[model samples]
Target: MASITGSSISSSFKLNQALNRVCCLKTPSISFKGISLSSSRLNQATRRLSITCAAKPETVNKVCDIVKKQLALSADTAVCGESKFAALGADSLDTVEIVMGLEEEFGISVEEDSAQNIATVQDAADLIEDLISKNA
Candidate 1:
């Protein structure tokens, strides 16, 4: 039993190495764990990686827009910089959706701790600005 287990582990390692080499070759696409990664997808990812630093006011306005849209608020709804999401009638799920909207809009991923710390629209704007700068 022990010999069989050891042989299986060694075979698995060799298979993984072979897969890595094949995936590393200049191919238009590669499949791993049932997910296909294409060159076009890689290009899109590279495009998304090109972050631009926007002015503070612009970031705030964009963040507000994302929040308003995520919450399905009226276009005329006032989203003040200091307004807390809770004040805007956002529940936990709403907050998560808002965070997702922000991520999609900015093309940047927010850490769990950082996302949890966002309470106000201004907080979200500030975090987004910071992320943009770091990504830039």
Candidate 2:
């Protein structure tokens, strides 16, 4: 009877530990999704991620720089050219990298199908702006 009691107590303690561990794991995830970071903090992070917005004239140039570096493309040609990524000779693998790079830089995930529709640099910037506002 004493051995049985000891086993029961040990099992209860293990169960409690398991529950506590689950709670600890879930707590931060719940808080992170529920809490929205302040704009100043977000903007600072965005700046660190290489997001830059200049006046209209420099806008395209900056966007091109971001796309070129992020996509590992030639700096000589403009990214604003009227060419879809698929039309620009990018394969499925290259397109995935491009999308991932954009998401990392913008702090948002561009849906796979929607990414296929992006034709110009402004399209990407617009989507990032929308996603940032929504996430905020």
Candidate 3:
């Protein structure tokens, strides 16, 4: 299977890095895998931080980083569960914004209802990757 990998970094750091990677450039769907973070290194990362994504591990980490930065939350505040948005601390507006950002980043349209249905980062990533494959 195809996968993309990267080193683990702070959530904000990952966001800046991903945004920079796609700065002002139209691109295809990004296929990346999980980011490896040593437990020790994650300790160095912001506290209560949670990273999750529907894409590969690397993409998941990137998404987690961005979300962490936007929400000013720690990793503990984030998760990759299959529940509801309210259960995940995402208001309707936050969900919409996140959906829009993910669409731009991965080139997919996440239906509002669909966005509401996504409770975990992995769910979101899987949806994005599925859309990418369909577009491809």
Which candidate wins on TM-score? 1
lDDT of 1 by residue, 23-92 (tens): 2133335444445666677445434432332337678788888888889988766675556788677998
lDDT of each residue in 12-57, candidate 3, tens digit only? 5444444333322333233344544343443333222323323566
Each model's total of backbone clashes? 0, 0, 19
Residue 132 C-alpha lDDT in model 3: 76
Model 2, C-alpha of 38: deviation from truth (Å):
49
* Candidate 2 lDDT score relative to the true structure: 0.51
Q: Decide which is better by lDDT, 1 or 3.
A: 1
Query: Clashing pairs in model 2?
Result: none
Better of 2 and 3 by TM-score: 3
Those runs of model 2 whose alpha carbons end farther than 4 Å from true positions after fitting are: 1-63, 81-83
Q: Write down the TM-score of every candidate.
A: 0.58, 0.45, 0.49
Candidate 3 segments exceeding 4 Å error: 1-54, 74-88
Local distance difference test, per candidate?
Answer: 0.69, 0.51, 0.54
Error of 2 at 62 (Å): 4.9
User: Which runs of model 1 end up more than 4 angstroms from their true locations?
Assistant: 1-55
